[model samples]
Target: MSQNVKVVQRASSSVRDKLYLPAIYDGMKITFKHFFKNLSDINAVDVLRYPEEQPQDITDRYRGLHRLTHRPDDSIACVACFMCATACPSNCMFIEAQEREDGHDEKMPKSFSIDTLECIFCGYCVEACPCDAIRMDTGIFSLTGNKREDFVLDKEQLLANKGAFGEVCSCARD
Candidate 1:
């Protein structure tokens, strides 16, 4: 098969265009227009005083921190299936499963930890979950720590995150 190549021609510039004076004036005009407009109505400009003043218009679909959902009986919804850990490309998710002593659930995570430093925030763990147990819709993206250990979120920490935002029922699907 033969492919045809299209020839392109450059647009010819006038003396004014070549001088670049009109472009500078146009840029200055836009700058001054914004300056005057902002001066007249301060609200027209978005000046977020973060940490002190939080944004009011965050959407529900915004992906933030990771959290594990709970069952109606207040127990963890996770079956310790290891699907999330298997799907994680970064290999940041760590989970150890154990038989439930209560005999209610088949299995429970003896230890579950996620190294935030290693995590790429790809949301694959959320997508790979089979029981609708995990979600990234907490909208709490300000994940910071002074020490490396603080970034390693354990099972308790992940569970605590679920309280901030309840179970995301509509997230994971086939």
Candidate 2:
């Protein structure tokens, strides 16, 4: 093969070009504009007086706190085969499996916890569960706490769909 080389050169900017900083000022100007706009519209803004106010409508797609769906008889629907644990990219899902009794429709989670502190809330665990037993449809995306143990989501909390109120939500039907 023949050896060949080609070179291209770009012209350097001048001191005047270096001195110009409109991009930085443009960013600052946007921030200042937003700040002033907020200041002027402070009263009109719908800032929730959260202690006294509540939302009436939330999107169905909102991924909030997780829920473990229950059968009509109040038994957990999860088979506890560790699919959620395996599907969780963040490794937040933990499961303890126990075999079902004779003729039972499903196996039960002897123990199940999604370590919320470690959960990235990507919804993979919810999507991976084949049995339609877990969901994140409550619109409560934030779960706050002071310790790691506090974020270990428990069965009681997992079972309470709140206003979903012991009923199946849209995620289940889909």
Candidate 3:
């Protein structure tokens, strides 16, 4: 479509021949950089010997894993709102809401479980919870199980972090 005729250009074969060697040398250069850097640190500061010694303080907003709080009455703090399950991106949370007939103000979660396998560690559910019932602050970085059912976290495990981890739940049964 252009009025000017396009001049055809040919790539020099010498450029192609030199490309492979440069790439190989670049790869070797990276390897040598790491090797020498590690060696220098080991001799001077001894930084290479203690990679595991430095641990990280997780951010206050870090979403590590799911947790449910148990009130002082040994009852679930969740009000069967299903906000957490609904907010979860992976659809890992399963909840069965049940009403309490003992003059309770709201319905509570009778059976709440989270499939650890399906969770992608996103914190949407934690942020969405209005009651502050569900949290992902156990500092638990990894979760595993032998069977499929073993990965399903129950209410007891969720509340265990509250007592042991010092994250108190001020929710009272009013």
Candidate 4:
């Protein structure tokens, strides 16, 4: 194999280029200009008051809160495969698997909980799900709670959080 090398050339600077004051002055000039413009047109600008008013256009790529899909029988679609928990790099996902008591399902989560504080929102859990039982398409960016325990989403909360388009599951078993 032939060796490949890159030669980078640095342009020489003049005396004026060495002076930082001119660059600082130029930056301040632009900053002041924009400041005056914004001050003058403060009323013209539309500011979104969050909690009360949310943005109308929510993109599909926006990763929001995680929700577990439900089967037609009003049961969680998750088979307790643990793919989501295994793929989670943050180790935030916790799942307890148990055999399905009813004849209808294969296996169900005894306790499915996700600590929102530890979750990095990497979307790895969503991608690893083979049954499409878990999704981050809720379009809910703002998640808040008065206490730490409230931020831990349980099975009930995950099931209750339906996406704007509705809960979608493509599991073949269902």
lDDT of each: 0.83, 0.74, 0.75, 0.88
* Superposition error at 21 for model 2 (Å): 3.6
lDDT winner: 4
Please give, for residues 40-154, the per-residue lDDT of candidate 3 as tens digits. Answer: 7876644433345543655655666678876767666788888888888899998898887655446887888888888888888877887778877776665666889888888
TM-score of every candidate relative to the true structure:
0.65, 0.69, 0.68, 0.75
lDDT order, best first, reads 4, 1, 3, 2
TM-score result, candidate 4: 0.75
lDDT of 4: 0.88
Show model 3 residue runs off by greater than 4 Å.
1-19, 36-54, 144-151, 163-165, 170-173
Superposed on all Cα atoms, the candidates' RMSDs to the truth, in angstroms, are 6.0, 4.5, 4.2, 4.7
Cα lDDT tens digits, model 1, 15-46, are 88899998899999999998999999988787
Query: Candidate 4, 11: how far from true, in Å?
Result: 12
Shift in Å, residue 68, candidate 2: 1.0
Per-residue CA lDDT of candidate 2, range 12-117, in tens? 6777557667667889999999889989988866677764676666666667888888765666777776888898888888777777773444567777887887
Which number leads on TM-score?
4
